[model samples]
Target chain A: MAMVDVVVLVAGDGVNRAIPAMLLLLVVLLAGLLGGRLVALGVALVAAIGFAVLLPPIGSPRVEPAEDVAALVLFVAVAAIAGVLLSTIVLSDRRRLSAEQGTVEALLRVDHDRAALLRSVSHDLRTPLATIRAAATDLQGFDHDPAARTHLLDLVIDESERLDRIVGNLLSLSRIEAGALLPERQPVDLAELVAACAARLERATSKLTVEVRAAEGLPLVKVDYSQIDQVVANLLENAARHAPPGSVVVVDVERVGESVRLRVTDQGPGFDPSVRGRLFEPFASATGSGSSGIGLAICKAVVDAHGGTIAADDAPDGGARITVEVPIDG
Target chain B: MAEADVVLIDDDASLASVLAVGFESRGYDLRIAATGGEGLREIERREPDVVILDLGLPDIDGIDVCRHLRQRTTSPIIVLSADGAEDRKVRALDEGADDYLTKPFSMPELLARVRVAVRHRRALAAVAHDEVLSVGDLAVDTAAHEVALAGRPVELTPKEYALLMLLVRNVGKVLTHRAILDQVWGPDQPLDTLRTHVSHLRRKLGGGAGAPQLVTAPGVGYRLLAPGDVVS
Candidate 1:
């Protein structure tokens, strides 16, 4: 309406006002295109009144009143039609722009995840492989020295085991990422499972002692045996890796109504408070131990698949504690 | 007596060769077969005292090979596989493999398992012996379901007793944590639970002053050492 008034005032008395009135109609239509139906209707009404009152005095041949009225009606109809057409185009274009932006953002996020995964894999894999190669070479060079030979062999064995673990974690993570994990659920004895995982860790890391405590007569939890085993094993491994040597890694299990809770607490340094939120995120290693950094993430995935929750926190006793709670029902 | 004959069937040539060197150093007759068919043929040619079969064989399924071997021979079969899945281990055991070892296993651990498997097989074939196994002051009556330390009967929970019994039966032999869990607490018991029970059993039996000791092999399993038996 303001633009229409400006055009009408500028085309006063010196010239025929028909061209300026047409320009005023164009301005109203543009306002409607950008501002939707309400603004377009408001502008159309204002433009019609302004042209009715101002056009005749500025006409070249002193036009009659009837001609002026017909001209005013024609200008209003044309403005309304242009407003509807342009408004539909504008609205559809806005929707399309937002949809395109969403796709681009998703693609960029996927690309970022891929790059992080590759960087983690390359770095983690190279470390143990390098250790193994170096140890193997040392073994050959130190063959005559029995004690040195034994030490080198031990290094080789340890490095190979580490490599095995990293590879296994990568495989499990990929499976989880790809939505390929289909857990075979059954009645699982949580105490027994915890003990088994601890025992395995105990065998692998002699310096670390794993202690298990479970509530008396804890009910059986329904979960996939192997996947759950991996979850517990991964958690125990993470605790062992971070905990001080010879310190006890305690595993506690209890029944909480319909859910069973499994908590693993270590005696090592607790996680950094700032990184606690990202503790379960893949490739978010606090220790920078060249680990694949997917252990806790895998635990999270497996627990989620079983309708469970997992969390990382500082233990009351000054170490990292990871808690996993899974429902007993299907 | 002649050394026990052993056969290892695996598709991993590097691992197989390294294991061959390890076994040869230990004074056992080691034979290698790269495929399941070759493994079966080798087994048919000579009945080995123990057979080590890798589940991920090149020619045939390791479980099928284990099944076939079990059908033909009574020899103990140890299944080696890279898969750590519980079901795979259970299935391999169900197919008559006496023991299952996941890959990346240390040579000492593998050798210990072989010894246990061989000892177990020999014991099964021997004539019936006295039901009581006495190691120093610690005595276990297999027939009576009793355990005694220093002339006094020691009380034990059912799980504890079961665990103690397994160790007493396999005295001086390293029992892998998995084996202990499977035999004592059924196939699905937790590993840490086994440790807890072992701790309890140790406390009850008493570990000093001439009593038999349950020595842990650290990352392996537990072994019951008689009073005079040195743990090396």
Candidate 2:
């Protein structure tokens, strides 16, 4: 009889029965809200609650336990289905976002690679062209006077050398960008490499005296011989350009713990104060005219890729000093 | 007699024509190849004494051209590149180019390399002298310009060999910096100029930097010592 009375109340006036049923459903729906499926499964739970409350009571006397159990099962089943759907939708959205992020990153890398290639290519071409022009221009001056022939020939020689440098830079940049430039790691003698670089620098620049301060029998470190050679050469050349004519460009190599440190210092104007913040950034040269600005950037890239560190600072002697540190094992 | 001929390849027509005229005035026969393909064809058809190859080419890569020429021809290939980019020189040499010249180069330097290439070619073909000029364990032929130490030949550049010859001729005797410069480089050469050339010689003749074969007199001049006389 009690069960029958409960059934009668459940089947009473639509508003009275629906209100209590809705309140009970709200309590269950809180689970969906807590599960982060509020937007996905909340509305379905409200409909189920309304149906449970407003349906007319059955004419049969006592409530059928079987029927009550069946209705409850239906409510739980629908709620579970809603939760699953909500979870699937959330997971799919996350996957799409991740994919989009990956694409953007790939695009950025491609753009950077392309930009570096174009800059290096253009720079390489300009060098040879400049050489030819200088050589021809000097020759023209020589033609006006045969005595000037020797001087004009000298100009041609210098420019041809310049052209060689430009080509080397372009090829190096390309290799770095392609990620194909693997270092031939070996137990390198820092003293030997520095000496070679300084010797070459002196040969290239008639006015500079390169002084090397590397102790003999320095322990060897693992590094790509040629790439490090290029880095040293670039630093020496930069020093030669900025240093006063006939001044000494000092190349110092020392051991710091398990790492080797090499520093090239010149008696020239140091980096511009304004550009110090972006020192290793590509195309960050203060001199807007006739400078490639790729030198430091290349140095940074090479050192970083090798898990090394490189820095530039104004020397106490009113010049610039470039210091590079490479681990012995790396 | 005309000077050694050179083939220069570049895309800049005006610059090429100008360089050709310059070379002509110096009594060299200049062949201009504006494209990489053209340069390769020229190298194949008529091998010039020296090829001034530019890295930038319209049709093909300059490095590829350099490699191809090195594979097929023994002609001295000099690479021309821009300033602040010297890494290419090593690569070109590794790829078989004889020497490299950077842009904004003086004309005198160009002629000097030209002379060196021509001299090297002559040395390779002519085998007149077989005796090795020995200094300590190190030996080299003055005429043949071949160097060997401990029975192994030491490769040297044209200028490096010349500098070594001058030093060896005055072995154990300190040659004044001025005297050495005037003898190797022309008169009116700068004082500091000798140091640069000497540094190159020391590297090639023996181990570089603090090697025992060449001794720097610090402010006076330099002396080439035998291997036994190497200072620690």
DockQ of each two-chain model: 0.01, 0.09
Residue pair clashes in candidate 1: A192-B189, A192-B190, A193-B190, A195-B190, A195-B191, A195-B192, A195-B193, A196-B190, A196-B191, A203-B219
Q: Write the per-residue lDDT of candidate 2 for residues A292-313, one digit (tens) a residue.
A: 6666767777777667899999
Q: After superposition, how far is residue B232 of candidate 2 from its true place, in Å?
A: 65
Off by over 4 Å in 2: A1-36, A48-87, A90-94, A131-153, A170-199, A202-229, A244-248, A252-262, A272-311, A324-330, B1-232
Please give, for residues B1-232, the per-residue lDDT of candidate 2 as tens digits: 6687688977654356456656777789999987778888898888788898876564676778889998878887877765344455555555666656666565666666676566556544453354655566667787678877767788887767777877665454445566677778878888767778777766666663323378775554666765544432
Error of 1 at B167 (Å): 70
Residue B50, candidate 1: C-alpha displacement in angstroms: 54
List model 1 lDDT by residue over A1-330, tens digit each: 533543454344334675767677787778877797667877877877776665555544333465555555666776766676677788899899999999999999999988877756765665555445545543443333565456557656766776777787888888887998777999999999989877765645566888899999998888998888888888887776667778998899999879999999999899877668887888777232325578888888889988899988888889999889999994
Per-residue lDDT of candidate 1, residues B107-187 (tens digit):
555666677667656754562386877767877788888888877999998889888877776665556777778887787
Candidate 2 at residue B13, lDDT?
45
